[model samples]
Target: MCYYLKLKYFTLHGPLPGMPPQFLLGNLAQSGLLFDKASLPEAHIAFKQRYGDIYQFWISSTRLIVVNNLNDIQHIFTHRNIYDQGDIYVQKFSIVIPHGLISSKGAKYKRHAGLTLPLFRRGKIVSNFDLIVDCVDKLLIRWRTKSPQHVHLDIVQQSQNLLLAIFGLIGFDYDMETLDNDNDTNKNELTKALQYFLSNFNIMLFSPKILSTIYFKLSSQYRQSQKTIEQYFDRMIKQELDNGKELIAQRKRTSLIASLVGSLQQDEEMETNKSEEDRKGLSRNELLDEMRLFLLAGFETTSTALAWFIHLMSKHPQVQQNIKTELSNNNSQGLLSLDRLDSLVYLDCVIKEVFRFCPPINGTVRTLTVDDRLPETGAQLFRGDQILIPFHSLARDTRYWSIDPELFYPERFLGADKDHHPYALIPFGGGHRQCIGQDLARFELKVIAARLMQYVTFGDGGNQVNSGGHLSKLTIIPKHVGVTIDFDK
Candidate 1:
């Protein structure tokens, strides 16, 4: 917390404070403190120390304002009427996911969010818990025969397999045998498509036009991946429409996409007497766009969270014991009753701490709808300017937490940090647009973590193999996560 002056400079948008000399490289693609890929969450802290909570990373025409303050993020997100998710997101992402909840604006956003929400409601998630855990059991069975005791498993690959299988079942009523098969090149088409698409979607979106022309010429694989995924959606949506009400009974227990399809089918059937223009059914392309976004968000977030949880548990044996002890006390005969999972208070704290420690989606961007001022620094901003709320900085700011923010202690939730600022640790974000699948994500994490702790012990695999860093892409995934798991009697 060094003393820094609030230096304001005039831009086309308005008066805004720019970054410090340390971030003078002024490159959003490389050295941007807010958007740096190599730096993970540390970049937010570095900029906060140099320029404080609110400032712009003004690189020429770019007027991206970075806000790490709780009040500021709260204000921006809470006032959804005033400020939407931002046009940059809509303009860029909508090209891929048309009318998707994240990409849709205003009324469309509300309609999509409201419609898809029931599928992720707490009751729906609980009833579907066993269905979700089916994938986890398959993964555990595979793990048992992978190698001998004290073997290092590439958790990055394992998590990808597990989540794809889980989401496949939940989302499409399909079985993706990514966990069973050993072949890489001949793996599931949807899995391959997702891996390729998420890895390259942003690059293709933001690259310079001339360079993008060159990129498209050279990116045959990327084009094929997108086409493959899109084709699958085309077939599914066409099948649902050409056939009729295939998944009505399992709508509540299935993926959000399934529910959407079932609902849309009902809408179409009810409007049989209406004109084509008056039909309420979602068009094929629109539903496909949402399906792509749903799969991308669904599989990535929970898997990344579980991977981090396993890594942390391996690092801190005591925390694992605490979770296991809680599970043992339940005396439940089954894998995990909803009541038993609910009672694991300590595991809940660990889940929260992991989200704070290393969030999958580090931060989100918003566009100002009207001229506004950041109250803390009094920096003036204009309409259409981009604002970034770095979750890393908010979670790490010592001022908001009673305990040290740098520590990996989950006990803080039960003790000193109990009263920590609500907006300080928003892994799934906050306000109206917070992650709709958070309840599902947390339930999945707890059930899997509890099962793992009950059946096995994570042995430290040493720094050489378990080297810690992160890969910042669609999600901030662990770049180096290798841990040894041994089954317990």
Candidate 2:
């Protein structure tokens, strides 16, 4: 690979460092290095050894520049017009969520972002505080059955179930009613549908185009799973349209339904084709797309983050006790107030450290919309070239850290890494492409972590059981998240 004369892309500008395209099988054979769909964080680490920080590789017919450099990543994100969301990603996600935030771009992306932004803002999240607490309390009541003695829990799996149920009751007014069940198979019908989708999501999204095409052709199961998501989404959208107001009457607070309807009403893209009287904000498919975005993304990423927080807390009992102490010292009158949560500075640090330590999302992709050169490297980027900004690399990179970035130490957030590069610890990404539901995700995680600390102690399940290695699919999930719950009496 060091031999420039032997390099296939030597003529292409930029640093040409990486395994020499595997010669015959190309980067496809070394796909594990390019991007490990099964275990991305470690794979990215390995790629750093072979490819260095920024390098080029071939994924089937596509040319990709995988970068972990903070400046290059920030440039791609900040210059939105020059680098757009990869259309391949849009195409892949559109299979399940058409015109949704992940699938749509330009005007459609703005429309979705604008309507949902206010719904997840800090104020709106505060309003939903009680509902989130109620959800966690339900889990606590069930955990009471296993109190006094420690019971092993697959906390990652459990958090997924819990967050799904909470989203149902809060966002869509549908009760999952799965909290009482001991069996994974015994779930609400809608929950079951989601489980089916999760179980059979397209692994093809990460594969080479040739391999993915072959996989898609052979599997009707993948298509069926997509249909399952669409069917569940459309039904929910209809139910919200018909009885959303009545459902929210029980809460007396605004439901996310209003945003869906508002977007639906103001959507006038098809107005020129339809009569002046028949303009609609979102078509039926568009409404379903937004619902898919809210439901899937709303629950899954947060649950993974919370799961990582718990897994890390179990390993660091001293840190956990500090959070408990902070909770006690800050506890006062109006239960579950954001002010109270804000007072727990240590808990906030632990949360940031958890995000830094185990970011659920591996990274994101963008396509160069025009030919350009990177600021520092002067690398040539042709229009439509792909850029993979590895989130795990940036978070774990030692260059930007005053404290050792490798440790699970939260105090780094308080002292040494206080002025760390803004782009370094971004688990949710940045600029125009940032996740819209971050405020709500943080709110849910904080209240839930506080409630758990108040009610139970997450005992470390030892090195074998609590061993942390990520199982990277779409999200970087803990490979083994076993923890023993010691219920607080």
Candidate 2 residue spans exceeding 4 A from truth = 1-15, 21-38, 57-62, 147-153, 208-235, 244-254, 262-280, 330-335
- lDDT over C-alpha atoms for residue 117 of model 2: 71
Residue lDDT tens for model 2, 1-489: 446533643333455676555433346556563343436667667778776878875543445688877777778888988998876677566655657778877666666566567667787677767788888888887777764455455677679888987887677776666686864456655566665666544354555445655665667765665576667666666776676555534433356765575445444465547753444456656777777778888888989998898889888999988888877773654255667877878888888898889998878788888997887655778897888877888888999899888899988878989899998988887877778888788878888898788777888787887887887555778888778888765
lDDT of each: 0.71, 0.73
Q: Tell me the lDDT of model 1 at 219.
A: 82
Question: Each model's TM-score, in the order given?
Answer: 0.86, 0.87
Tell me, by lDDT, which candidate is best.
2
Model 2 residue 216 distance off true place after TM-score fit, in angstroms:
5.8
lDDT of model 1 at residue 257?
A: 56
Relative to the true structure, candidate 1 reaches a TM of 0.86
lDDT score at residue 212, model 1, on the 0-100 scale? 42
Q: After superposition, how far is residue 180 of candidate 2 from its true place, in Å?
A: 3.8
